[model samples]
Target: MSCLVSSTCSLVPFDSSLNRPSRSSKLGSSISWQSSFPRLSIEIGPVISSPIVKKESFVQAAWTRRSRGEAAKRPNKKSWKQRTDMYMRPFLLNVFFSRKFIHAKVMHRPTSKVISVATTNARDIRTNIPSLVDDEACRLIGKLIAERSKEADVYAVSYEPRKGERIEGKLGIVIDTIKEHGIIFVP
Candidate 1:
């Protein structure tokens, strides 16, 4: 028997007598302990003479049948968001939070050009801000970035939050500030 506790147990052939209690010593006073379980027999087959053959997996078969054009398509992770969204959404809003600063920027996706950038590290912002990493700093950066993007004629943009990361707290404050500053966020 293959078990977690131990593998020392060996299968024994079934015993018909162990199926029921002995009728001759059934009285309560005359009792002898006996196992009631029927032992099961295990059969082991001879080892295969031929070497084991490797079967083609479903994924392998599908890959083999795939067209050359399909094979040439993007295979990296988040290809849809990175490639498709680049063209679909012309303007991209990206925000980065650092230990001591908040950086927000807008990019023109088609041209791969950085359109507007606002950061707490800038001389003007750095000199005025009391705390560079707080919500107020994020809001200031967000508002400045949004206004700059508008000056570049980009009113609608898209922000893709990191996968599995919540858009709340400081990040949320930045985004909300941008919207309040008249920047439209595309779904």
Candidate 2:
């Protein structure tokens, strides 16, 4: 018994510019452009490519591009320290104790009473007194000192003026004794 299966096959030519290699059949016949191209002989397998294109993914790509463009347009910002130092470098010389006194003098308050000086770990209100001093006062003092002399560095020590009050008489006696020791008050 003999069996013959007749089938109609369509052949498509592969473009060489697309880098597709040509194949030949076993029998040397007229080189048909259809047969010259290799068959993609994929086995019965799962469909890998999805027919539906994702529209949301395109939106994400567009957003990414927009953000990149916006970033390129904006100037870089200075860090906190950089900005602060830019404004502070000039006045840094006047931040000393003697300078502070001179600044007080220029402000017509040379004998500015040491209004409850204190030290604290907190950046603001470094005085011993718990009464909250505002930022304006601190800034004003700093500005005054900066405007005056740039000598004598002032550091805050934990000054317990209230405790010192208990020994005010003793302190006065000490001052008197020092004065007698030729401590001339050159005012």
Candidate 3:
């Protein structure tokens, strides 16, 4: 099966010296001449161009310029830690990972009191996990935090991951282990 489509296009001639639309002197119409370009005809699958054109408005141009100027004057945004501290929560869990160590802390957010801690630096964690920096070590830390938080009767926590780091790799392993051990993360 086949289909055919054809479209007519109008072209406005430009006066060389003036550089604007030149009226038709011969036909006495808006179109100055029959454009040498052929009418667009297409078959089946090819794309076709449209005749409608867009013109820029003075109001739109002015509005864009004003918006750009305002954007340039906007102040810097506050850090995530600053924002979280301002809007205090009931409980929060902060996990920090360094090159050779991983640390996890559960806190009473409103009063900023440290409730529980799990770190590779701790003797217990060091004894259980051979390495302090790997994913397995992070999972062990998560399990330790889960156990301590349960004893403290803290069930849920707002997980505060390190700034500029995604919740993947070692961080992901820690979070999964915590959930597996019956602790819920509050995003």
**What's the TM-score of each model vs. the native?**
0.58, 0.14, 0.52
List where candidate 2 sits over 4 angstroms from the true fold: 1-58, 61-66, 76-98, 101-187
Instruction: Supply the TM-score for candidate 3.
Output: 0.52
Task: Flag clash pairs in model 1.
Answer: none
The residue pairs found clashing in candidate 2 are 97-153, 97-154, 118-127, 118-128
Best by TM-score: 1
**Which whole-number lDDT from 0 to 100 does residue 121 have in model 3?**
89
> Which candidate do you rate higher for TM-score, 1 or 2?
1
Please, what are the lDDT tens digits per residue for candidate 2 over residues 55-161? 33244344323355666776475546767643333221111223122122211123332322222223553354243233333334433333222232332211123
Backbone N/Cα/C clashes per model = 0, 4, 0
Top lDDT model:
1
Q: What is the lDDT of residue 186 in candidate 2?
A: 21
C-alpha RMSD of each candidate structure in angstroms: 19.7, 25.1, 15.9
Instruction: Please give, for residues 1-187, the per-residue lDDT of candidate 3 as tens digits.
Output: 1121234222444455664545556757554334423333222223454344333212234432335556667655554677776355578878888988899898896678898999998876677767889978987889999999999998988776566978889889988899999988775
Write the number of the candidate with greater TM-score, choosing between 1 and 3. Answer: 1
Assess candidate 2 and give its lDDT: 0.32
What local distance difference test score does each model get? 0.74, 0.32, 0.71
